[model samples]
Target: MAEEEEEKGGSKKKLFMIIGGVVALAAGGFFFMGGGEDEVMAEEMVEPEVVEGEVLDVGTMTIVLADDDPDKLRYVRVGLALVLDITADSSLVAGRVSLVQDAAITVISEMTSGELRGAVGAADARERLSTAAREIYPDGEVIRVVLTEMILQ
Candidate 1:
């Protein structure tokens, strides 16, 4: 009976050693793989600052869009403004305002009424106008394209 008791005690020690080893390995893995890397990365992330710039009015435009109905017509009237750096040369845009207006008209006139419906549509139009303006102006000349007023019908 003493030998039986010793054997049971020995088995308990082995079982405890195995559990301890597993716990140690799990702790080691967590420290090695899941350490403060995510926290460090989060700390390094930064948001861009919004810079206030000068506004240049590109004037209002009324564009006619082609519709499916032969007798009906669709149109959009949009007022635009261009944001430029404070020190940017206004003459560059003012001298070529007509060209910018033409580009705006071309872009807005191509879209159907449905494409210009929601906030997403307005954002898309703004992006397209910005791209078009960039093509006409040098880099950094036009900082952003602003839609002062937009009416889709």
Candidate 2:
């Protein structure tokens, strides 16, 4: 009976040691793998503070334009419609109604049919429109510029 008791005690000691080793290895691997470094660095990179005057109340706007020629006017209307739909649905212009309207008009006026279809043309248009809107309304920040429509017939 005494021998049996000693054997059980030894087994328990072995089990405990195995569990402890596994835990230590897991902890060591976690630290050695640099798993937490990214999180630490991300937390350290803070956003810059915005002074009170620098902040702007951005808004969205809509505009409609038509050419004198019937065919051209129809194309313009289609383009305008596309622009409106895109701008209205845009997540970036959710609260900026005035900016969206101004941007749509500015983009449409500046765009040629070829430019509208070319590679990187839409991006250029968005950038130009956003810049123009910002200049027009310096008090309002334009977060995004969307192309809702392009119709040139």
Candidate 3:
């Protein structure tokens, strides 16, 4: 009977050791994996810088793309918004909206499907559009061009 009791106590000690080991591992993992700091750091990292501006929506337009293949018809529908400085005159930008639209259409229509395929292409288009608008607008007036919508078909 004493031997059986001793064996039982040994087994109980083994079980307790295993439970303690598991708890220690979990606590170690939590600390090593940045348990609470990860969440706080992520929140801080995800917040974008605040940009103060007057946004002018230039509206959407559909244009036929200049594709090399004559057998297929390709087109791109794009919408643009102009971000102007807070001190910029919006009335001047509004008055010349037609010119901005014309410039956007011309730029997109000249691009082939291969040139407007991915993120790079989209950014290129935006940069070109912004450049074109900047030429028309006065210095320090136009801040940036935002592509609201772009669909190629």
Candidate 4:
């Protein structure tokens, strides 16, 4: 009976130590990742954007997916928006919406379902679209490309 009680006590101590270690590690991680004053300091130290930016809704587009196997037909419908550097006149980017749309359709329609399914593929698509749009306006930069809606069928 005594040995059994000792065994139980040892196990309880081990459990407590394990719990304490986990708590300590979690607390350390939280503090390390800007959980306290570090977060406020980090935010305060960052600089703000110099150039104003604006979002342009590119709207929805449906592209027939390039499929390796012809037996199945697939399509992707995505809603895209562009963040562009703000200018005095809206025509800077607004005037080129048609060009952006044409570039997007031309690029996205060429990708197979397998090429557009994962996170990497999505990022690649964004980069390609951005490049295509930039090609339209060689002097201007598209700040960011947003894929608001992505439906794969």
Candidate 5:
């Protein structure tokens, strides 16, 4: 009878150990799966809050510059589009609009009749114009300099 009682007590202890192990395993799984309220709250606390800024609308400007020829005095009209980068600091980007326009004029004036005639010439002129615009707004980050209208008369 004593041996049977000892065996029953051993079984009960084994069952308790198994139950404890299962409970521990379940708790571990819940925490690892991000199921606990504390875990969810920690994630929410760590996430970055987004703040919105005021939007500034930049305008496009068109400029007409006379060619180098004194007698004919041919003029080329170019339409340029400008947009301020919201990501960039506002103070730096504010004063570059006029500089970009002036640079475009300077670039167009340098083009000769020979340079403007062929397909290669037009491409080269465009690159030169882009380079000039970039130079003017070194920090301002000019997105694009579009030559909408090119007329030589």
Candidate 6:
């Protein structure tokens, strides 16, 4: 009975040692293989600061869209605002304000009433106008687009 008791205790110690060894190995791998050097030092870790872009209110536009039904032609009047990148040339945008308004009008006129119905649709239209601005003025960078006073009639 004593020998049996000793054998069971020896088996428990062996199991414990195996589990301890596996845990140590896993922790070691996580420390060594991962970017554990600078990551472990909380003081050395730093995140980049995001600077907000400068906003430039270009102007308002009244776009007339021709619907398929002659009686149902629609017009959308919207106010456009552009978020200029930090490195954008303000003079270029200021000098071409009329051109920018024309682009906005062209973009809004191309869209049908169905595409400009809801908030989501308006957001999409804003995105397209931003893209148009970038293309119309390749030298300028438009980071964000906002549409206001959007009236569908």
Candidate of highest lDDT: 3
Model 6 alpha-carbon miss at residue 80, Å = 0.2
lDDT of 1: 0.86
Kindly report which residue pairs in candidate 5 clash with one another: none
Give each model a TM-score: 0.64, 0.35, 0.64, 0.62, 0.45, 0.61
Cα error, candidate 4, residue 90 (Å)? 2.8
Give the residue spans of candidate 6 off by over 4 A. Answer: 1-50
The segments of candidate 2 whose C-alpha lies over 4 angstroms from its true place after superposition are 1-100, 137-140, 148-153
lDDT of 6 at 135: 81
Model 5 — TM-score against the truth? 0.45
Candidate 5: which stretches are off by over 4 Å?
A: 1-69, 82-94
User: How many clashing pairs does model 1 include?
Assistant: 0
Q: Model 5 over residues 63-123: C-alpha lDDT tens digits?
A: 3344565776555545655443344554565566667666766776666666665677667
lDDT of each: 0.86, 0.52, 0.89, 0.83, 0.61, 0.79
Better of 2 and 6 by TM-score: 6
Residue 56 alpha-carbon offset, candidate 2, angstroms: 15
Better TM-score candidate (2, 4): 4
Write down the RMSD of all candidates, one decimal each: 5.8, 12.7, 9.9, 12.7, 11.0, 6.6
TM-score (C-alpha) between model 1 and the true structure: 0.64
Error of 5 at 32 (Å): 46
Quote the lDDT for 111 in model 3: 97
Q: Rank the candidates by lDDT, best first.
A: 3, 1, 4, 6, 5, 2
lDDT of 5: 0.61
